[model samples]
Target: MNIIEVEDLTTTYNGHTAIKNISFKIEKGEYVCLIGENGSGKSTLIKTIVGINKKDSGKIIKNIPPEKISYLAQNNMIDLNFPATGKEIIMTGVQKHKCLPFYKKEDYKKFADVCKLLNIEDIINKQISDLSGGQRQRIMLARALIRKPDLLILDEPCSGLDVNITKELYNILNKLNKEDGLTIIMATHDLEEIKTIGVRVICLATTVKFDGDIKDWKGEM
Candidate 1:
């Protein structure tokens, strides 16, 4: 099944074209890596797919509803000084579907399951500011997963992390995609980092430069 289909998509920011005439289709349960140089429209394309930015032209057909898709943007935008606990942050994912401010027993249980899967159960009570970069990323991922989304979109998820930590994060995402059957589309410039988990590669340079299996992507890096 095609989870997302973008046909000749174009997007602009303040009248400046970001991505132009890009087209692609994301299949169900596929792990796709969006790669390109800086300001090459990788972020712009995914943002358009996720509906974060409006497309200036073309059509986007999403098999899943907007609410069923979970997104993790480029950077952690939450205030580090915020006193919210890990659990509190994760529970916020359920707020969109809730009529009350408080979580029910099942909501708490789902949060616990997601925490255990992410291996952050020990820090559930800890403040977000107290965790390491990796731990904090995991918390954010857990929060994204609390929605049980069919499609997971992440933008430059490993922007400022060491190689080892970045690989660990990919392993977690691999498990989620391979084991749990979640379709994932992540944008990153580091091709080496995705060598282990990348099933498909979509290289964009303000357009569709290449779109094929990872092994067939022959562009010079």
Candidate 2:
């Protein structure tokens, strides 16, 4: 089943075209990667798909529920001194209504399960500001998983992490895609990590340059 279909999608900023015309389809439970150099419309395409930036033309058909699609951007700009615990930050993902006065017991249980699944239980009580860079990334991932999103959209998920941590994150993502059958669409420039994850690769150089098995990338910039 096609979870997302984009036809002739285009985006412009101040009359400058970011993505000329692009088309693609993401299947259910498929792990797809969006690759391109900087200023090559990778981020524009993602923003357009997620509705952060309005497209200039074409169509974006999302068959999945809006809430079921979670987007984790490169820079997660949350205040460092917000005074929120890691668990609380994660629970925010599961909270549907922002105005809700209290969290139910089931919500807490779900949060705990997600933490355990991401191996972030030890940092649950720690403040978000006190965690390491890799730990913070894991916490953000746990928060995304707490909502049980059907389609996960990640932009440069392993940007600042060390090689070892990047490998660990890839392992978790691969497990999530294979074991839980979650559909993942990630935009990244990490070629090595891409090879390790072994997903379908979609290279966007202002348009759909390549889309196929990652093993066949050919290293063609």
Candidate 3:
């Protein structure tokens, strides 16, 4: 099943074309990576996909509900002093309109499961500002997964993590994808990490430069 379809998509900023006439389709349960050099419109394309920016032309067809599409931004924008605990931050993934005096039992169970899976249960009560960069990223990921999103859109998920921590995070993501069949769409510059995940490759150089099996992508680094 095609979860997302983009045809003839175009976006421009200040009279400068960011992405020109790009097109692609993402199938259900498929892990795909978007790769390109700096200024290649990768971020612009992601913003357009998630409706943060309006497309200049063409259409996008998303089979999943808009709320089911969870985007884990590269850098979280929440204020460190917001006074929300790690668990509280994760609970926000539940629908905002749903009125509830407290998180339901099921919600707590899911949150616990995610924290365990991410190996962050020990820090559930800690403040977000007190955690390391890697821990913060993992918490954000747990928050993303708490919603049980069908499609996970991440931008530079391992951007600043150390080598071992990066490997650990991807290991968790790999387990999630394999065990739950989650569909993942990530924009990353980590070519080595991409090879480790072994997913389909989508290269964007101001447009759709390549899209096919990962084994077929022989572009130079």
* Model 1, TM vs. native: 0.94
The order by descending lDDT is 2, 1, 3
Candidate 2 residues 75-186, lDDT tens each? 4556767798888888878877666758888888888788888888889899988987788888888888888999999888888778888888888989999999999999
Off by over 4 Å in 3: 99-101
- The 10-residue segment of model 1 with minimum total lDDT is 72-81
- State the TM-score for model 2: 0.94
Write one digit per residue (lDDT tens) for candidate 3, span 73-156: 774555766677898888888755567658788888888888888889899799988988788888889889988889998887
- Extract clashing residue pairs from model 2: none
Q: Write the per-residue lDDT of candidate 1 for residues 1-221, one digit (tens) a residue.
A: 99999899989976789999988888899999988888888888878887779999999999988778998875466687899998888988877767777878988888988988888989989998999877888888888999899999999988886777788888888888889999999998768767756579988888888989888888963
RMSD of candidates 1 onward, in order: 1.4, 1.5, 1.6
**Lowest lDDT 10-residue stretch of candidate 3:** 75-84
Candidate 2 segments exceeding 4 Å error: none
